[model samples]
Target: MNIILGASGQVGSNIVKELISHNLPVRAVIRSRNPGFDSQVEIRTADLFNPEQLTDALEGGNTVFLLTPEDPASNDIIGETQQIINNYKQAIHANGIKRVVGLSCIGAHVEANTGNVLMSRMLEQGFADLDIEKIFIRPSYYFSNWLGFLETVEQYGVLPTFFPEDLEVDMNSPIDVATFIAKVIAHKSRSSDVFELVGPQKYSSRQVAETFSKLLDKHVELQPVPKEKWNETLASAGFTASTTANLVDMTQAVIDDIVVPENPDAVCLPTTLYQYLKEKLEK
Candidate 1:
């Protein structure tokens, strides 16, 4: 059986659908009951931090899809994430799970001080010694992240971003990420591997604004947030002090070009920014 953690989330939900379409046996692990999944899916409720619950969720599962969700309001986000990773390790061991598909980020190879990317680094390190087939899917910055600014773009014709207007950075669609993950899970490989996933090309904040303008039929402009104001902007968005600091550090790493794909020949998904935005708008 295949077990999907965070099954209600954007990527995980899509993975569930993709696997179900192939008529595979799946057990969806979620924190709460969600009626959105197909009736063929077996639903299991488990808190990631609770070892017993997680163990029960992984019972009889051969391959598990794992990811750590960020909690911006937590006082100790890193500590909480470590505890959850520990729980996953124990559960996988106790249930004799054979494989794990970890959802990681592009800069996860960097061993230290990349802020939020550190979480993915820890995940890789934590599971390194397990006697199981491990596959890490390291994806670029998510295109869905821009969805948060849709309201601002519609109302004010402005797109707010931390990066400079001209700095090109890697980005990918969550749908594409999910599709690749489902494929990996279906075809379990023998040796451990890392797959770096990105969109067809890199994009700049200006390019993103242009795409939004074309899709929205408005004169949307890029509004770069000054570094001095990152704190205030994040605080107004309700991030706790520590979370804001982590996010700012992560943003700076991106600007410094520190966060990057380790593999030069990383797989590029077919969806372009314009096509993704057009489909999203049509929906």
Candidate 2:
């Protein structure tokens, strides 16, 4: 059976759909299973931190999708990552899961310093210890994040452009990236791989606003805010300031043209910002 972590998320959900579309049995290790999945897929709820439970979840599964959701407050990022890696490391060795497709970030293995670079570096360390065949899908920033404030943009004509309006953002629709992941996961290959998944073009804040305006048929304004201000804005809506700052800094990096896709094979897939907005907003 195939296994997918973070199965309830947008990427995981779309991957499960695609795997089912290809008629493969899937085992999902998720905190909560979404209702959209087929009943044939096995759903397991277990404490990820517990080594034994994590190993057991890998049982009877040949492939596992490793998608670790971030915890910003972890004092020792390296230590926290080690704990997570030990689990996957043990599972890969014992169960010998042939294919492990890890959902990671764009600069995951790059030799550069940036806002989200820490997590990518840690994932690099964690992945290195694994014995099984692996593929790391270092996707660019997700476009779905913008959908959160669609109502605000539509009604107020203003949107919190997460990254700078001038920086080119490597973006992708969650669905398209997941499809490629599912294809790789279902059909095993002898070769190991790491691929960056990005949108067709780099888009700045103004460009994103332009895309929104064209799709929604209304003028959308790009309103840049300070990291602290962005924190206050997010806190009012129920998120921590530090977490918001990381997001804001990441966006500002985009504006400063700091983010880049290092992998030459980074795919320019078929989802556009306008289409995402049109489909999401119309709903």
Candidate 3:
């Protein structure tokens, strides 16, 4: 059986839909019961942080899709991920999970001093001792991150970000990532490996704004929020100090070109930023 963790979130929700479209049975382990899923899907209301509940949710599940939730209340990203490591290890061992599809980011190759990438590195290491098949998906920066700037666009006709306006970076949609996950889950003889998923093209902040402008049929300017004021700006926006600091460091790494794919030969998904924008707008 294939079980999905973080099934209520955007990527996991889309993965559930993709799997269902293939007429496959999936167990969705979510913190709350959601009405958005199809009737054929099985929903397990459980908190992954709770060991007992996590073990229960992992029972009878062979292929597990693991995605950790980012809690804003916790300022310690590393500490939080450490707890996740413990939980996953205990639960998978107790339940005898045979296959794992873990969600991670491109820079996870770095084990230290790389902000959020540290968590993914730790997660990848945690599962290594387990005698099971594993696939750690390292996707590029999510294109849906632009949704955070939509209010700014509506209010000021501008898309603001810490990234350089002209610095092109790999971007992928959640839908494309979900599709890839579904395919991997359905494939019969996939060995344990790491995969880097990216969009059909690279895009800069300015190019993203231009794409949005074309879709919205309005002038949208790209504004780079200054790094000097990042702490104050992010705090005002309700991010904790640790999160703000990690984000600043992560964005700096991107600017320094330290977050590129470790495996350039990995397959790229076929979703373009323009195609994603048009579909989102139409919805």
Candidate 4:
């Protein structure tokens, strides 16, 4: 049996659908019932932080897809991740699951000084000694995250950003990420491996704005917010102090180029930023 945690999320849901499209039976472990999934998929409701509940959900599963959701309400980012890793450890042991595919970030190879990347880095490290065969999919930033900026563009004719305006960065659609995961599941090879996923094209903030302009048929300018004012801006935006601080650190990592893909020769997924944006706009 194959199990998928975070089944309601963008990447996880896409993965669930992809697996089902291939006629693979999947057990979706979710915190709450979401009727979005097809009837062929099995549903298991459990709080991910609950060891007993998670263990029960993993019962008889041979493979598992793991991802840790962010809890901005918590002040202790590292502590929260540690507890999650611990829970996964306990659940994996209880079920004796052997094959695994983990969703991680691109900068996960950085051992230190890369704020949010540390959470992913530590996640991969935690699974190192396990006897199970594992493949970690470290993808670039999700293109879906930019959807939130469309409202700003529509209202103010500008897209706000924290990073440098011309800094080129990797991007990928969640659908593409899921498709790659399905491929990995079908062809499980290495005992432990990492695949760096990215969209067909890299985009800077200006390029992003240009893409938006082309899609929206309006001139959307790039508004680069100075890093010094992030705290005040995030606070005004209603983010908790801890969440704000964590985001600031992660943004800094991007500015420092710590989140760039480790493998320059990594294959680009079929989806492009323009294609993703076009789909969203058309919808």
Which candidate tops lDDT?
1
Model 3, residue pairs in steric clash: none
Candidate-wise lDDT, in order: 0.92, 0.75, 0.85, 0.87
| Candidate 3 RMSD computed on C-alpha atoms after optimal superposition onto the true structure | 1.3
Q: lDDT order of candidates, best first?
A: 1, 4, 3, 2
Candidate 1: deviation at residue 159, Å?
0.5
Please give, for residues 177-274, the per-residue lDDT of candidate 3 as tens digits: 99998888888555899999888889999999999899888999888889898888888988898887777778888888888889768668998999
| Candidate 1 wrong stretches, greater than 4 Å | 33-35
What is the per-residue lDDT of model 4 for residues 234-276, given as tens digits with 9 covering 90 to 100?
8887777877787888899988887888888776989888999
- What's the C-alpha lDDT at position 136 in model 2? 81
Estimate, for each residue in 142-233, the C-alpha lDDT of model 1 and write its tens digit.
88889899999999999999999999999999999999999999996788999999899999999999999999989998999999999999
Q: Is candidate 2 or candidate 3 better by TM-score?
A: 3
Give the residue spans of candidate 4 off by over 4 A.
33-35
Provide the lDDT at 79 for model 4.
Answer: 81
When superposed on Cα atoms, how far off is each prediction in RMSD?
A: 0.9, 2.5, 1.3, 1.3
